[model samples]
Target: MTSPLSHLATHEVTNQPPAPGDRDLWAGDIVLRQAIARHGGQPGALEPYARALGTAAMQEAARDANRHPPELHLFDRAGRRLDEVRFHPAWHGFMQLSAEAGYAALPWEEAPGGHVTHAAMVYLASQVEPGHCCPLTMSYAATPALRTTPALAPWLEKLQVRAWDPAIAPMTGKRAITLGMAMTEKQGGSDLRANATTATRDGDAYRLRGHKWFCSAPMSDGFLTLAQAPEGLTCFLVPRWLDHGRNPILIQRLKDKLGNRSNASAEIEYDNTLAYRVGDEGAGVRTILSMVHHTRLDTALAPAGLMRAALSEAHHWASHRSAFQKQLIDQPLMRAVLADLALDWEAALKLGLKVARNFDGTADEHRTFARIAVALAKYHNNKRAPLVIYEAMEALGGMGYVEDTPLPMLYREAPLNGIWEGSGNVICLDILRTLAKEPLAGEMLNAELQSVTGTDRRFDAALKAHRTRWPGLPPEAEARWFAESLALLLQGALLIRHSSDAVADAFVATRLARGSGRIAGAISGCDTGAILARIAPVE
Candidate 1:
């Protein structure tokens, strides 16, 4: 069968505008049109290239936003490429479909579906492909304390090989070749202060010795690895193949993961391998953190996409499936559920777009909003999606639990959203920390709340009541309390489109009138409706 994305191959060539009826295609098409216009209509110009790359990258990311493979295997058991297998093309087609649909794509053909793919693609394009040199180059850039690091002048020139290569393609729908970021050791995941890998300064080259766990994209061409230099933590570029020498790294094991099975996550060892320092020593953590900030956003987006897909399935199921001699759509309960899902999905989608905009260079206010928005979207979507999946399944009776239904896969994959990037606890803590540092964040939040309350006196009254009832507290305590409260605030901000104060206020009022109890539940994390109500409310 011809895949839905078969049209994309000829989309540019034909010069036919996208149909206005399909919102996904229209969104992408409009963006592309604006980008082309901004670039003076020359598709090959640098600005145009960047814009096209960004647009295509987003589309690619959305293609596999939700769904997981049957197994975790970017490569076969024998450590051979899995893309060579027959199923690769089908999976690729599926990815394109998701992208065209404005859903998320998977890293590997069989990985769990979600918005992470979009974030990953964007991160790869912005940070890895355009920001730094290859993984090897990034490692070399982090040598011996990062102070004496040489300018990347020579390496940066050589990194242009990626532009022509185009790791991701809209027409062919091929996956990009990855350069693994393998930094973690068994002793530590985030606490790089405890990494034990060593890089001894050999005569002409550094000899690396270490074991790395969670080496993502292990089968890629090279790795950006972190090692303990005599000076401090340093990074190195270790290639899979050398022009004149044999491969130096050895694969120890591939992790059997709960999600993202198509992307290789391996345990690896390097023994006396020759390496070049990236930047100065002790800069490894800082450099990697920069890279990871982008990666975390990507990770957060993946689950956002998954939740969207799950909600979509729920919407479809509710509208079509029948029970108790009536269509599920006829039930007030189901309508409420579906409505909440729609609201949540729209909020997440808008939040994801806003984050992308900030990454593309928006104001500091937008940047702050994007951070809070992304975190809240990830938190709420991760929690809400499974319930939608469950309700969808329940509505479908036995069919929902069956493998034949997408609901089962969505249910299994939903939990990973919360775990990947960072757990809910970690993200919430980060949000709290951000609130602590920026008194302005709270003020901005309060402004937002007031704006929302202004639209409906009732909602304003409710918010005032809640605020008054909530005692005055220190910044730290306020941060904790505000985590959930801020989520609600952002939810209102998003629903109002953040485009106008009045719309946001109206959304808050409507939500308050219909779901005060549910809102309270969300803050406490007890009832699923707390999350659901944010998305689909009674009103």
Candidate 2:
């Protein structure tokens, strides 16, 4: 009984992009706004760029960058050794925008709560496109290490520049510059101490001769690499170009990665490459430690932003599409799922920024708390981002699985953050190390939790249990479990203080009191509608 025109009508599509923004992506996020306000930032100032990032043009740039991944040109015409990486224009556009936004060196500028402000901006920008943020993160991280090396004092001006100068040239000629890192070798993955790259003494500098298996942001103007010097493992600043010509950093190849397609990671061989040693020759690990901590914070924050992006997409789709003659969002189970995702997102924001705020504090206690808490936050939040994003994707059914939508991209990006900087086992072991070596960290954590001693009976009981049994640390076999417990306890405490009654109640009931597994939507009947409404973007 159907007419021929019925087929044409059925071809219409529903549920898609063009999500709303507050002239800035930062202001639209209630949790982000709360965190920013608490940290003394005027969200309105970031609105313009945030709105630009959400535009069709910027979103297209993200897709185009990934669609056309960076390609390597190992040789130029006439068989000259070129060793360059060619990227799409969209990649440069993304880089330039972020660079101008001051994501790389805002905290170093000594702004009020600058680290928190930087973290929030990074979180917002990452939701738009994460791959381009890689080099930006490295530049931001490298500032600490660079500050310690007096020999490189003049080059410090280049790092502080806010412009995006992507020209592949000598740092001496460039007005602005970005930094990269090459630490891992074939034999050493996370264990930088085992690096086999050797740096021999040269006149006023050193000559590096070895291979780096993972050289992040190979196109960067400079890199912070590790090599074995006469004393021990050392850190060196290897410029892309030297006085004579381009450094002899032979680009073995660009890694064919699963995700982060917009950015380039390379494997390179250093053939007597010139480099300037930073810090004491044997104190490489100590010198790069601060850099590592900064990157880890961004690593944890990226996934949280990725989760928010996925949730936004899913929520937008649900709000528009109808099934069984009812809007998708109106369904009870979907409500529970979205609400649960929102709860996790809020927890991630609260915890991530809490650690960042500690970075800006001048007190010794704040530094101690950050030392232990950063590891805890990075481990749990990064590990959970993928699962959370996948669940949010599931809320979309078949459409979420398709490549045309952003879900596929978000899904692919989920594991990158957790794997980078440090993987799950590595981060957990770091937490255990902190517990064994740093007593002040534990004391600060305990004191922080005790502030809300009677907020929730469940949280109080869990804290008591943790204090009593935490002295005898768990063995390596159960380090993950121990770390997860610490992270959950910290999140619960932060929520009790920062979050509203509804969010706090839901988090404590599911994460602490019940002690349930990792299933999304496990917490039910706890103002699911309220949380979902707060997080869902208003169009």
Model 1, residue 201: what's the lDDT?
94
Candidate 2 residue 268 Cα shift, in angstroms, is 0.5
TM-score of every prediction relative to native: 0.65, 0.96
lDDT of 2 by residue, 225-301 (tens): 99999999999999998767999999998999888989999999999999999888999999888899999889878
lDDT of 1 by residue, 154-227 (tens): 33233322222223222123232234578878897767779999999987458899888767655444567789
**Cα error of candidate 2 at position 244, Å:** 2.5
Model 2 whole-model lDDT (C-alpha atoms):
0.85
What's the CA error at residue 7 for candidate 1, in Å?
A: 34
Number of the predicted model whose lDDT against the real structure is largest:
2
- What is the TM-score of candidate 2? 0.96
Highest TM-score: give the candidate number. Answer: 2
